[model samples]
Target: MGTALEDSEIYQKFARITDSLLSPEIEDFKDSGGKVVGFFCSTVPEELFTAAGMLPFRMRGTGSTSTELADTCFTPINCTFPRHCFNQALEYEFEFLDALIVINSCDHIRRIYDNWIDQLDEPEMIHVMSLPRKTGDRQVDWYREEIAELKGKLEEHFGIEITDDAISDAIKLHNDVRRLQRELYELRKVDRPPITGAEVLRVMVAGTALPKADYREMLQELIGTVRGLEGNGDHKARVLVTGSQLDDPEFIELIEGQGALVVTDATCFGTRLMWRRIDEDEPDPIRAMAQYYVHDRPSCPRMHGDQPRRLDFLKELVEEFKVDGVIGERMNFCDIWQVEHFMTGGDLKEEGISFTQVDREYILAGKGQLQTRVQAFVETMKGTD
Candidate 1:
């Protein structure tokens, strides 16, 4: 799998999508007069956007390695992840975005949305929705209403109706993407998976950034190539990384370079995005998307009262992937995950899993310190082995 993917043109395209905000594929899509809707968090019901005859692009600060432009509008005290994305927008990097839909998943992101409206003139349309912090029957209903409202806004703004058939098709398309991603992860169930964690992260990012149909085809091709490959399994340990927004492949490479294989990650761009598929059987596809996004999706720290659910998912990944330890990292100034680290770390301890937590800026620095810690964790896992 590794050999085939390294040689595949599709894999190179996926890698390029990860390194750039708008890939040539997307640029061409926009140039053809396609509507592109940019979104920030997973909480947004993207299937709705897709069904609305618009392309949903996950906004990231991938190319903006520096926050110099963002710092002018937002102080250093804000979370760097959103700031970095804002910096990219300020530089007209995301000029192709026709509209933006933001969710209040965290304070930092919400503030960035506010600044985006106030300071930016591109993205002719923008909408902010409040994500319910709880997962319950009533919360699901509330989210369903929120999704309906978003659909209405898009319909009015674009003068297009998102009919049931369009939504049903979108649901199936997204589910197919999730199914292929899960199959890719299942390859890592082997002691030494054919692909590396950095590769997995890149594929996941590509799924979000590229056109769904195009990504789905590329993924199917990659999966078949991976299934026939064999891994040496010579790494010191198999690790699972959980964190606040880990879109950068370089950070995963840095950790893997420490003689550990990152088999699975529980971050937003990782398992959280791929774990669940929308309920196609539901009479109304809109309600199905709402249910899946609010209840069935992987729980983030922001989902209050879902710590147990989150832990169970992590434990499942640890057991399934043969993880030696878990890395809990939070973006610097991300208070939500910062508080979650203690709770999650304690639970992992009781379950007899080794856990380590670290804080990082949006773009990583202090590589020497990070490598030392990961190397120590690798040694610990190796000693136990």
Candidate 2:
């Protein structure tokens, strides 16, 4: 198979496994070693966790079906993605996560850290890190202190001290992946790009679970190869996706494959990460972190402290991206997206922008239905009336 075909086949296999067989396999893997499980959000580095010779898994949300575990602590307005995923951790789905490294990037997630410690009595399973504040160096020391503290926790958990070399290696792995992802993103920025939205998402999710260096190389090669193709595919409707934890890029794939250009994003799994950069020469790493956490476009309900600015941010993307429509994807049980969907779209619609809303499941069970809806929406937007 060609690289694209091979990669597609691999994803098809994993999706089937995710659908038909992988739960038990992942369960088995979880059981094989009582290894360390870490969660790094936005700015906090995940490199250290990987360097410790521990199986580091990024925290993902659970499925759409509701659970009482999350309700005990979080309000009804919290984003359902994290609630569902974290609830799974609290319930039966997370037998493998020895500990959760929670980054206090936004309000609700930070609050969740405390709930995990107190209500769940999960002192052993929770490591909280307060992200640095963007406008100042005052918080850098505090962030470094938190990093140091997390290192101590990992040491105690694994019964081994983390070495400086391990930290450097882990940072290199994650940083390399970031570099490649940036290149992959550039393909779409070009007039005619080869890779699909689904392909992009597949590579990104794999980055979380696979070895970063290899992942980066494969992505860089994929983009480099794809950019050369003079894609003659039809793409009349132009759209941008805005949502929470929409890492799969399936929305973009589904809509664009039919006849739409998914040109930009406001999704955490995409632009939110894509826009932020780590300043190598900053007095402390926390400075870069603080900027990412506080300054990235805010969409989650919990991050609404300074949210008046996000509306303008969305407008900037719409204008710059030349978007003809917007697709607001909400996690099925996500309280935050549910709210933001209405709020953001309301602002755009009033200005005569075309848009649609999709409530998605983690596994993308109802994608065919979503595809049909988007196609119809695109037709309407095109004035094919």
Q: Highest TM-score: which candidate?
A: 1
Note the clash tally of each candidate: 1, 4
TM-score of each: 0.97, 0.72
- The candidate that wins on lDDT is 1
Could you give me the TM-score of model 1 versus the true structure? 0.97
Candidate 2 Cα outliers beyond 4 Å, as residue runs: 1-36, 40-44, 51-55, 61-93, 103-124, 130-145, 159-173, 228-232, 248-258, 296-301, 308-321, 332-335, 346-353, 361-373
lDDT of 1 by residue, 1-385 (tens): 1334666676787899888888888888888878999998988888887787778898889877788888888888999998999998889998889899889988888887889988998788899987898988888899999999989999999899999999999999999999999999999889767889988898899888877888899999888878877774668888899997799988888888887788998999988997988888999887898789889989898999999999999999999888989999888878789778888899998988999886788887889999998888888767744
Clashing pairs in 2: 61-85, 62-84, 62-85, 80-334
Model 2: how far is 74 from its true place, Å?
9.0
